[model samples]
Target: MSILRHWPSVRARVGRELGLVLALAVVAGGVLGFLALADLVVGGETVAFDTQVLMAFRQAGDAAVPLGAPWLPTVMRDITALGGTAVLSLIVLFTVVYLVLVRRPAAAAFVAGAVLSGAGLSQVLKAFFDRARPDLVPNAPIELSASFPSGHSMLAAVTYLTLGVLLARIETDRRVRVFFPFVAVVLTVLVGVSRVYIGVHWPTDVLGGWLIGAAWAMACWGVVLWLQRGRPALAADG
Candidate 1:
């Protein structure tokens, strides 16, 4: 009887501890991301690191010959397309429609808002930095936009992670809940890597994209959690 009585208290304590840990993690991530962006903007050591990594992928004297198989460039181009505007937009549209059909209009709206806002923020930051593209690589993609942060990397992180969290929320199985976000992160990382492989972005660009995108996704998740907290009974009923 005493053990049973104490079990509830123990569980509650554990839950509170977990919540605290998660909150701390989110704050730490956001702070680190902002620091990185500030360093990049101020032309700190990060710039040198970015240049070194960007150059390492190319041949010593010839930026055109990326250090990979002859066909790797083609493969990277294909992989990069997965994070392009067209593909991500289609993904967001389909997800919103699916959520609406399933009668979760709020969740659908959250998804749309998170992705669209993230895309807009990316453009604004790019223009604000107005950094030039890497001219070291002759075969790099011809991008006219500023290149401080890669659009593909940031948008991919935002869209995929937002969808991942949404999918995880609907899963009843614990394993499935974990799996959804894991796959989402994997896809995001792959997309970012493809940008560097193709020489369209500096390493720091992708890093900045991932950091800001993740921070944005986490913020949206907090909103979802807050909104849902008030409707626990309704959530349980569904």
Candidate 2:
């Protein structure tokens, strides 16, 4: 029997809930991707709200100059560096070590799968959209990929938020469990913004990344819960 169908009603209900969330994410990602594709076909340009996001990205880039707030730019740079290779390596190394140390090999596999999937999806979307990065800023970070949704933002959301969901199982305080992931989410959002501020990404790009990441993360969490359903006494923190 397919696990979803084999599940008892309670587990089935949980699966359905997860299915719903994942469905929504798929719909949202599809819609956003379609809209972006359409925009590109029709001479890609931001609509009003999207334009605002781009403007915000631009202003953020300008403000990051570090004249008055010397450290502000540096801080933003660190966050913005999420797209850089060094940061990516750090994330990879940390995840590998953590999972190995904790003996949660499955957790590591799921996380690696989910993060890599999301990252690949983001790149495919970029190529499909084939949108161009803005020329408004000076010394734009060397990006040659299509700029529809920010890859950094998308990957960040997928990777960090997935970790957050997994972490939720380990911390049962209700408050801590729910809140910490939210903090990760907030930081992910900031990381997206930092990219925009650096003038390396269009605002819409980051927004797309956020939407995609959120949707994918929800879907992964649903799968994990489904797998863990029968064994309520599973490793989750209460």
Find the candidate with the highest TM-score and give its number.
1
Q: List the residue pairs that clash in candidate 2.
A: 149-205, 150-205
The RMSD of every model to the true structure, in order and in angstroms, is 3.3, 5.7
Q: Give the TM-scores of the predictions, in the order they appear.
A: 0.86, 0.76
Candidate 2 local accuracy as lDDT? 0.70
Instruction: List the global CA lDDT of all models.
Output: 0.79, 0.70
Model 2, runs deviating above 4 Å: 1-70, 83-85, 232-238
Quick one: best lDDT, which candidate? Answer: 1
**Model 1: lDDT of residue 187:** 87
lDDT of 1 by residue, 1-238 (tens): 9989899667645644554457447747965976667575657657687778988888898878888889988888888887899999999999889878877777788889999999999999898888877777885779898887889988998999888867766686989989999998998898998888778888888888888888788777766554444244112232
Clash counts for the predictions, in order: 0, 2
In the range 60-161, model 2's lDDT, one tens digit per residue, is 556334232556767888987765546865886698678868776777777778877887888888888777786666665788888777788887877778
